[model samples]
Each structure stands twice: as C-alpha cells, then as structure tokens.
Target: MKKVKKIIWLIGLIYVFCAMVNGDAVISSITTEAETTPIEDSASYLPDKEGKENKITDPNNMGDSKKEHLDSEISSGHIISQETLNKIYEQNGEKVAYLTFDDGPAPGVTPEILDILNREEIKATFFPIGENVKKYSDITKRIYEEGHDIGNHTYCHIYKEIYSSPESLINSLKKSDEILQAVLGERYHFNVMRFPGGSFGDKLAPFRKAVNEAGYSYIDWNCITGDGEVISAPTDRLIETLKKTSQGKEKLVILMHDSATKATTAEALPDIIQYLKDEGYSFKPLSQIEEGY
Candidate 1:
C-alpha cells in the first residue's frame, strides 16, 4: 500500500513540473510577440509628406535616394573664380610653365591643337573671342569639356571696339562671358581676362579699374611663340622664340594662338612641350598662375 502511495506521489510531482515548464514557454512566446510589433507596414522606416507612412514604389532607388543626390553634387563642374590667380607649387625646385592659346576655337586649328595637347597629356588655357566662341560653340564646348580653362578675350577682338571706353570693354567682357557660359553650360564661371592685344597702355586704365571692380583678373603673357605678330609664322622661328623667352623665367606664361590661319603654332607645340620637359619645366594652364606677378 505504501509503495502504491509513493508511486502516485512521484507521478503527481512529474505532472506539476511539466505544467510549470509549459506555462513558462507560453508566457515567453506572448512576451516576444508583444515586444516585436511586426514590420508588415513600413511606417517604422519611412515617413511620408504628412508625417504618415506611404506605400513604397521601387524601394531600391528610394532607399538610396540621399546617396544619389550627394553623388550628383560631387560630379558637378568645379569652376575657379578669383581676382588673384592662386599659385600652384611643384616640389623640389621644379619650374612651371603655363601654355595659353588666344583667339581660338577656330574649326580646324582648335581641334588640331587639342589633339596635340591630348597627345602630350598637357592642359592649356584658351582666351576665345566671343564671336569666335559663338561661331564655334561646339569647339568651345570641347575645350571646356577637355578640362581646360577659358577666359574672356572680348566679344569682337577689335582693338577700337573693345578699347573704345570702359563701358565698351566691360560690355564686351560681359557678353563674351555669357557666350562661354551658354556653350560651357551653367556650371562654369570664368573670372579670368586677357586683353585683346595684351593688357597695357593708358587706354587700359579705366578698363582695368572696371575689371578689378567687377571681380576679375586680367593676365598678360611673359613669353610668346610669335604667332600673334605674324600669321603662320615659321615653325622654327616660333620654337626659337619660345626657347629664348622662356630661358631665364622659372614660371613662364607663354602666348600662342589657335586661330585658323596659325597652323604653324600647332606644328611647333610638340617641340615646345618636349623642350620644356627637357629643361625640367612642368606644363600647366593659366588658371594655376600665381598672383602679384
């Protein structure tokens, strides 16, 4: 009888223990479900315009929309604009040269010059007349797209017209700038200027003051390829002029032309580049010109 009683007690204890474990499991499941608050609706992640959740369409792009917006801002063109051209330095006492071509974007000449520059992996600044840029907008676009700097060289490239008065010069510059921005798109802003026949003489006083007041920097070349003086100057003479003028200058800004008639300038470019390289001079664009020179 005692053994029967002991067996009954043991069976009752086992049933009570099993019930307790099952109750604990049920309580745990209920607690987890209450805490989770299922994500079947996206209200937890994205908010709509009225501070409510909206149904998602194309989740991939929308999910990364912020990143895409930032990327577009990064890819926008970086236009340099300042009165004083900032200096760019080369380490270890290296010489720097800026190769600037003026009065260009002429159909055949500009393209050929671009090819030579591309072949040599060099960058140059082009001061295109407004009329020329309007005439050859496509080539002007190419110049900007190829990562070269463009400066205002006046609308007419006419000495009498541009140098007529301060107002005339300023108008010419403003018009030329408009043409370039139109061709190069809205992302670019040019504050660099180069006078038609070099920024000199008493005639330039008022124009210089106007340009300075308008937040622009005017540049004059220290060396020339002689292409400006004579149309289609001999290749040898052009090369010699470059070599002679650039001899003592550690930071040389060379003047050359890319007008349709000056094919010789294009021919002499490779030799000039090679000679500069041999003399341990680095080729740069006028945008890198140092101020107070």
Candidate 2:
C-alpha cells in the first residue's frame, strides 16, 4: 500500500513539472511577438521626402547614385563648396592626384583622351560642354561606361550667356541636364562643374547665392598646364608647365580646355599622362572634398 502511494506521488509531481515548463514557453513566445510587432510599425516612418522626391527609377540604377543632381551627387564629385580641406593620411600615405578636363568631349581630342585613359586603366574627370557633348554623345556614353566621372561644364559653354544672371546659371545647368538625359537616359546626370575661367571673375556674382542654394559646386583651377594660353605649345612645354604647377601640392586640379577647334592641347595630352603616371599619382573625379583655387 505504501509503494502504491509513493508511485502515485511521483506521477503527480511529473505532471506538475511538465505543465510548468509548457506555461513558461507560452509566456516567452508571447513576449517575443510583443517586442517584434512595434519594430515593424516604426519602420514605416523611416523614408523621408527626399527619398521619395528624388527616387530615380532604373532597375540597373535604382540605388546607384552615380550621376544624380548637384545636391545628390556632390559627395561623389569630390568637390567641397562648404568645407575648406580634407586630410587623409595613413602611416605611409601616398600622393593623390585629381585629373580634371574642362570644356571637352571635342571631336578628335576627347575620343583620344578616352582611348588613352581606357588603355592605361586610369579614370579622370571631364567637365564637358553641353553643345560639344551633343556632337559626341557616344564619347559621353563611353565616359560613363568606362567608369569615369562627367561633370556639367554648362550647356552653352558660353561664359557671357551662362553667367548673365542667377536664373541663367540654373537654366544653363537644367538645359545641360536635359540634353544629357536625352543622350544617356537618366544615368548621366552630372551636376559637378567647373566655372568658365574658374572663380577668377565674379561673372557668377549675380547667381552667387543661388548657385549655393541650388547646390552646384563651382570648381576653379589651382594648377594650370597653360595649354590654353600658348598657341601651338609643344608637348615638352605642356609637360613642363604641368610639372611646375603640380609641384608642392598633393591635391592638384589641372585646368585643360578641349572645346576650341584650334586647341593644340590634344598633341600634348599623351606625354602629360605618361609623366603624371611616372610620378605615382592616382586619378579621381572632382568630388566635394577637394582643395580650392
């Protein structure tokens, strides 16, 4: 009789323990579901208006912000309108060079420049003129295809027309944007730019406030190869000028023109590239964090 009582007690204890474990599991499951529900609800408010307004639509380029508008693309262009300087130094830092060409996508020269760059596996910035761009839309396409950065050099490339007023600068950029869109779909929307004659003249003065407001970064040259100044300049002269101007500066923004019909700049380009390569410089597009004029 005592053995039978003992067996009954053990069976009852086992049932009670099993019920307690099941009850604890139910509480844990309820707690987990309660915690996770609030997180899902909060995520609905995460995306802002800019995310909606500037949502570029291309499956291939859905999140690729390579050539968005000025405000969106400034960070990539490596230009700095607001900041003064950038200091990127490692334990053993190497030299950095930003190769920028202004007033380009010309007939023969721009193509040659592209070919040379493709051959050498070097990428540089081209601040191309809109009117000239219409002539060589293929080169513009190649520029994007080859992983080089293209910036708006203005639609007309006419200094007087573009800098006439604040609205004019904005309109010029818009026009260029429109044309580039036509040629390259929505992908080649390059808002990074170089002002005609750089910031030396305040012809952009009328639009000064608006330019910043519109989020356009105007680039001026710190280093000039003087290929634009000298007519029929030899390759050696151009190379020497580039070397002299690029000296003592880790960040060099070279100003070269490729718009004119009579530009001798093309002949000197290959030598300049070779010389710069020999000097252990890596090329980049004009971004928002560059040193100024």
Candidate 3:
C-alpha cells in the first residue's frame, strides 16, 4: 500500500511542473507579439504618392509646408511690402503728391483730365470701375498707355453688392481685374485696389485682411476734391476742398473722380496741380511710391 501511494504522489508532482512550464511559454509568446507588432496612430498617417498610408517624419513641419505651398500659389504681381505701405500712410516730411482718380474712364472727363496731366507732365493713378472699363475700353487703354498707374475699383461699384462680405469684395475686384485684363491685354497686371467709400472703421477689417492675403495693397485718400460728394461741384469748390483736406499733410494721396458727371474735377485739375507744385510737392504715381522705400 505504501509503494502505491508514493507512485501516485510522484505522478501528481510531475503534472504540476509541466503545467508551470506551459504557462510560462504562453506568457513569453504574448510578450514577443506585443514588442514586434506596431500600433497605428491615425493622426500621424498621410497619403503617399501611391495612395498608400505613410507616417509623417515630422508632424510639426506640416503646417509650415502647407503655408509655403499656399503662398507659392498666390499671385503677387506688384504687392508692396507692409513696411513700405506704412510709410505711405504716415507723413514722412517729404512733400509728395499722388493724384488718384476713381470711377473713371468717362468720355469727356477722363480725356480732359489726362490732357491736363499730360500738359503738366505729371503721372497719376486711375481706379477705373469694371463697368466703365467695358463701356470705355479705349479710354482705359489710353490711361494705361499714358503711363498712369491703373488700380482695380470693384466691378459694379455698388456698395451693397461689394460690402456684403469679404468674399463678395474679393470677387468683385477679381471680376474687375478680368475686365481690365481683357481691355489691357494679358501681360498687364495690377496689385493695387481702392475700396469704394474707402476701407475705414472696424467693419472693414476683414475685407482689408482678405485683400492683403490675396496679394493686393489698398490705399485710402488723405485728401479729397469732394467731386464724389457733390457731383458736378464747381471748380472753385473742388479746389477749396482740396486745400482744406490737404492741410498739414506732407505726403498727399489726393482723391478725385473723373466720372461723366464730374466735369468740374477736370476743370479743377490744372489749379490743383499748380497748387501742389507751388507747395513744393513732387508729383508721383501711386504705383511708384514703393520704389522710394
């Protein structure tokens, strides 16, 4: 009886030892699998050229790369640097006058204005609305050929349509550019714009940002002839308004209109130019202002 009990005890000990060895082997296999297999990070995966998923080497550089791509795609034909733009806005003690005509290329008025500018030997900037450019392509071409800087002034010049949103304003400017290009040829490009009613107040902040992002610069007038305020204003009143608005400004971006109704502006141009010249101001086109910087 004692011999049989010893045999049973030995067999039970052998079974327990085998079970322990199998459990250790199963744990080792699981650990090896965990170390060998890779866990995917969904955020780190990007599409490869072959349309397969690939891991980004450095996720931090992705934003910068994307920004660079976007910047390269943007057309910066004649975009002025922010520093140069700031100098234009601030008075720099140098007497410079930039005569800018908006809503123009009219039959009689634009020609008269151009003739006066030619006689004075001064080059000015003209912001012709797209509608007017279509109506008077010849005049627009003439203004460009005469060595005047041409800027985009929205398509329809309707405040409600343009001021509805920043996108609306950009679209209008682009549409006007298309019209201008059609008139001026494919080689002609302009990177300057003027907001109708001016880009002022907090309301236009988004529009200003959008314009800059689109690689365009905009200027607002520091002096005005009030031709837009009172269509067909008297020549003397226009001159007086110019004098009043131009007071104490060393750098003047003088605004006037050459729309069909603004014939008086044409009449006032000679006197306005004379006054600026007498004030020791050198006339410059708006496009050339960046060259000094």
Q: Which number leads on lDDT?
A: 3
TM-score to native of every candidate shown: 0.71, 0.65, 0.72
Q: What's model 2's overall lDDT? A: 0.68
lDDT by residue (tens digit), candidate 1, 1-293? 99999999999999999999999999999999978955443233446778776644333445577556544654424334443443432233558888899998797789999999998889998999999999999999888878888888999988888787888889999999888878777757768888888778886788888987776778787888889887688999999999988877777778899998988888888999999999988887765554323
Q: Which portions of model 2 miss their true places by more than 4 Å? A: 1-93, 201-203, 260-263, 287-293
Clashes of each: 0, 9, 0
Clashes of 3: 0
Which stretches of candidate 1 lie above 4 Å from their native place?
A: 1-83, 86-92, 290-293
Q: What's the true lDDT of residue 149 in model 3?
A: 89
- Tell me the TM-score of model 3: 0.72
What TM-score should be assigned to candidate 1?
0.71
Clashing pairs in 3: none
Candidate 3 C-alpha error for residue 13, in Å = 99
